[model samples]
Target: MAFREGGAIGTALGFYLIVVSILSIGIGPDLAILSKIAPGVLWGTLLLSALLSVDRIFHNDYEDGTLEVIALGPLPLELVAVAKATAHWISTAIPLVLMAPVLGMFLNLPAHGFWVLVVSMLAGTPAVSFLGAVGAGLTLGLGRGGQLLSLLILPLYIPVLIFGISTMDAVLVGPGSFSTSFAILAALSLATVVLTPFAAAAALRMNLQ
Candidate 1:
């Protein structure tokens, strides 16, 4: 399904590139300023780009009755939630992560920080997809739920964003070790991967009823 929805992936990737390009232009030619803010900007834009398609995670399935059939199958809804979120991670987050290096160049991201930025994003973006599934499931079938979904999910994304940037900063010029922050970011992703499916599954059940 994710592969079939090429436009959605393109939209997310385009959003990531366009936002980074605009920010680079807006920041003027100051490489110093650009590098200083690069980590935050990259992390923030990636999260927003991921948000662009999050509402569709379950919305299409729900609308087409595929969700009902999946829910009734022998597999648990929590695993279904996991499957959907994993597909989202592959379709959305991986593309964004792959593009981060190119975008990071626009932001004048440090050479040393490139590897850290990629690693941090890889560690943290799963939380974005998994936690987003919860909001997607909660807002399923609602009118104009995208705005509410943003409200509900962006807060949950903060820790991931913060740790992600911190991981970059630590690698670039840090008071703390890179492993420390990266571990926290990875832990956040793991926690969401383990827990949010249950929450998303419950939300789906409520909506299905």
Candidate 2:
């Protein structure tokens, strides 16, 4: 409700799309340079875009006391955490994934790398939402803790960024190369998705206590 009412979902999507579009233009029509950097630029933009929306994961609910009621309800707080993170991924990350191919084309990304980009993003971005939930939970009462949330969350995202780009970079070498990176990225996302809900639930419990 808060995300819809506040337009945060649209803002994050629009912001990253425009930023990537501007980057594609600002870098000029040099396909060689754009293609060379496309993986890094696109992945970085996705990370930043996810960061902008993560704060809202728990902020409004926490403020309005809904989170406390949810905590006391039959649904476990950990499951609530998972649900919020999943909703964030659907609302925020999926749009980014859809736009990535078109943005990749705009940056003159190689056809081979295009599918790799989409696959890597699909595999890796769920971690952003899951981990961001922990960050948002930790910073719940900080009063506009978006900046602090980014600081707390961005470091944890480093592995995702590294492997996400490596997935594309390794594509130039051989199938085995990108596959290995994508596997690690998938592992990371899976681990975060499985574990961070508990962590976030703990954090929310601390805040509530």
lDDT of candidate 2 at residue 38, scale 0 to 100: 89
Candidate 2 lDDT over 35-107, as tens digits, reads 8888889999989988998988888888888887887889998988988899898888989888888888888
Candidate models: Cα lDDT each: 0.91, 0.88
Q: Which stretches of candidate 2 lie over 4 Å from their true place?
A: 1-6, 173-176
Best by lDDT: 1
- Pick by TM-score: which candidate is best? 1
- The per-residue C-alpha lDDT of model 2 at residue 60 equals 81
User: Model 2, residue 14: displacement in angstroms?
Assistant: 0.9
- RMSD value for candidate 2: 2.0
Q: What is the overall TM-score of model 2 with all chains considered together?
A: 0.93
TM-score of each: 0.97, 0.93
Q: Per-residue CA lDDT of candidate 1, range 14-127, in tens? A: 999999999899889999999999999999999999999899899878888988988888989999899899999998899899999988888888898888888889999999
Q: Which ten residues in a row have the lowest lDDT in candidate 2?
A: 1-10
